[model samples]
Target: MSTEQPMAMRQIVVSSAEDIRVERVPWPDAPGEHEVLVRSRLVGICGSDTHACAGKHPFIALPYRPGHEVVGVVGAVGPGVSDLAEGDRVVLEPNLVCGKCRQCRDGRYNICRELAVFGCQSVGAMADAFVIPRDRLHRVPDGVSDELAALVEPLATPVHAVRRAGVGPGSRVAVLGAGPIGLLCLVAARAAGAEVVVVTDVLKNKLERAQRLGADAALDAAAPDLVDQARRALGGGADEGADVVLDCVSGQSSMTQAIELVDKGGTVMVVGIAAGPTTIPLHLVQDREIAVIGSLMYVHDDVRRAIELLAGGAVAAEDLVTATFPLERAAEAFAASIAPDQLKVLVSVAGPG
Candidate 1:
C-alpha cells in the first residue's frame, strides 16, 4: 500500500491595500511538461510585496498573490524535467520571459518585451504548494538553510547591479542605503573585491548592520555634511570621488548624492525603485560623462551567481532574516516587514521542509 498522504494546499491572497486573506485552496495537480511542483518552504517578504499589499506597487495588479522571494522543495517534476527530483531544495527565479523577445534573443531576458513576474504578474509561491516552470527553479546547496535560500531572489538584484558597475579589485564603492537591498549590495560589492565601501543610511541600526556586513564605513545620510563624511570614508577628499556609486535608495536626494560622490567618468548604478520622478543634475552628468546605468531585475545568470555567493558564504543571508511567521499569519508577517526593527521577514510555508 502507498504511504503518501493526500495533498492539501492553502494560499494567501491580497485583495487590496490592507486587505489580505488566507483561504483554503484546491490542491494543485501534477505538473505539466516543462513544469515542476514545489512544496513551498520559506517566502521572504520584500518591500515590493508590502507595496503590493498596500495596493501601491506600480506594476502589481490587484487581487494577486504576493510572494516572489520564495524557496521550496521539489515534490514532483514533469516529463521534460530531468535534473530536479523529489525532495530537492530549490529557489525560484520568478521572472517569466518570452524567449522570442529581442532582449531575450540577446540574452537580456530581465528586460524582455513580454516579461511577467511569478508573484506580481502571475501566481505566487506563498502557498502550501505551487507549480513553476522547470527553468525557473534553481537548486539550493545542501549547506544553505531554507530561510537563507529564500533570500537568493532579493540578493540577485544587487548581484546584477554590482556586475553592471564592473566592481573589481581595489574599486571604491559608495552605497546610498542600508536596507535589505543596500546591505546585500554591499556584500556583493565587497565580494567582487571592492576595497573601500562606504554605506550611508538614515538609520543608525541599519548602518551598524552594514558595517557588520563588510561596509568599510557607514555614515548617516541625515548629517549636514553627509557628502563630506562619505568622501572621507572613501579615502577621498572633497575633490576626489569614488569609482562607482550605487544608489540603492534611488530617491531624489540619494540619486543626487550618487552623482556628486562618483568620480568624473565613473559609473552610477540605480538599483532601487523610486516612489516617482526625482530631479537630477543632468548638466553634471553630461559634463563629467558619468555612466548612469539602471539595473533591472536579474537574468538567469544573476540567479546562478546569487546561489553561488550564498552557498559559498560570501553573504550571510541568514543574518538578515530577522523574523519569520507561519503561513496562517502572513498578514502579521507583512506588517512586521514594514516595522523599523526588522531586516527581512519570511513566512514559513511548510515549516522548514
Candidate 2:
C-alpha cells in the first residue's frame, strides 16, 4: 500500500532580510545515476541559518531554503551506486567537491577549489526529499539513532578543526566560546588525548552545559581575571599557556584572544566567521612564530569520521540536542536556535520509514 503524502512538500524561504515564510515545493522522487534520494529525518537549525535569516550570510540568495545538518533514510539510489540501497539510515555530507582541484587531487578535498554545498551554496535539506550525488552520503551503524545521526554534520566541524590543530596527547587546548561547536571541540580534543580542555564563555547556563559535558574548567570570558583563570585552569605556570587555541566564535576580540592564548609555535584554528574587519597583531604573530589557520566546512571523510564517533560512543549526540521541533514548526525551531538558552535545535522530518 502506498502511504506517502500526496501533497507537495512545504519549504521555508527567506524573501527579504529577516523575513521567513513557508511555501509549497515539489516533492522529489528517486535520483538519477550517481545520486541518492533521501527523505530527510532531522534538519538542524544552525548559527548559519540565523545569519541567513538576518540576511547576514554572504552566500544565501533570496528565496532559498537553508537547513543543512540533515540525516535521513535512502529511499532510492542512482545507477552504479552499489554501496547504498533503499531503507539505509544515513547522514549526508553537505560538501559537493569537484574532484579535479589541486586539493582534491592531493587528497584534501575539504579545500576543493570548486565545492558544492547544501544550504549555503545550493538547495538545502529543509524539504521533504532532496537528491544529491551518492558521493556525499554516509551510512550509519545499526545502533545509531536517527536523532543522533543528524548531529554528525555539526560534530564533523569540530572533528576537522581539532584534527587541523593536531590536538592530542599532552596538549593543552583552550576553546573560546562554549557554544555547541566549542563544546564539540572539547569533546574531540579530549578524544584526541588532549591533556587539558578549558572552555570559556559569558553565559553560566552554557558553561554549566560545558561542565556536564566533561570540561576540565569552564571560565567566564567576561571575568576581570579571565586570563588568570584560563592560565590556572590550563595548569602549569601562569604563562605556560595553551599548545593550541581554538576560536569557535566569530568576533575580533575572540580572534585576538585565540592568538594571545597560545604559546610560542602553537597553532590557532579559527572555526568561526566574523562579520567585519578584525584586527590582527602582525608583529606579535611574526615574533611568536604562530600559525593561524582558518578552517572551512568539513570534508566528506570528516563527516564519515563523525558518524564513526557516534557509533563508537566517543561523543553523545543527545548531549548536544537541547531541543527539537516538528518540521511544521521550523519557524519556531529557527527562533529557538538563536535564543540565549538553547544549544542545538532540530526539525524532525521523516524517521524510521
Highest lDDT, which number?
1
Best of the candidates, TM-score: 1
For model 1, the stretches where C-alpha displacement exceeds 4 angstroms are 1-8, 351-353
- Residue-level lDDT of model 1, residues 292-317, one tens digit each, is 98998888889999899998987675
User: Over all chains combined, what TM-score does candidate 1 have?
Assistant: 0.96
Per-residue lDDT tens digits for candidate 2, residues 310-331, read: 7888767768888998877777
Query: How many collisions per candidate?
Result: 0, 0
Clashing pairs in 1: none
- How much is 303 displaced in model 1, in angstroms? 1.4
**Candidate 2, pairs of clashing residues:** none
Candidate 1 weakest lDDT stretch, 10 residues: 1-10
TM-scores of all candidate predictions against the true structure: 0.96, 0.95
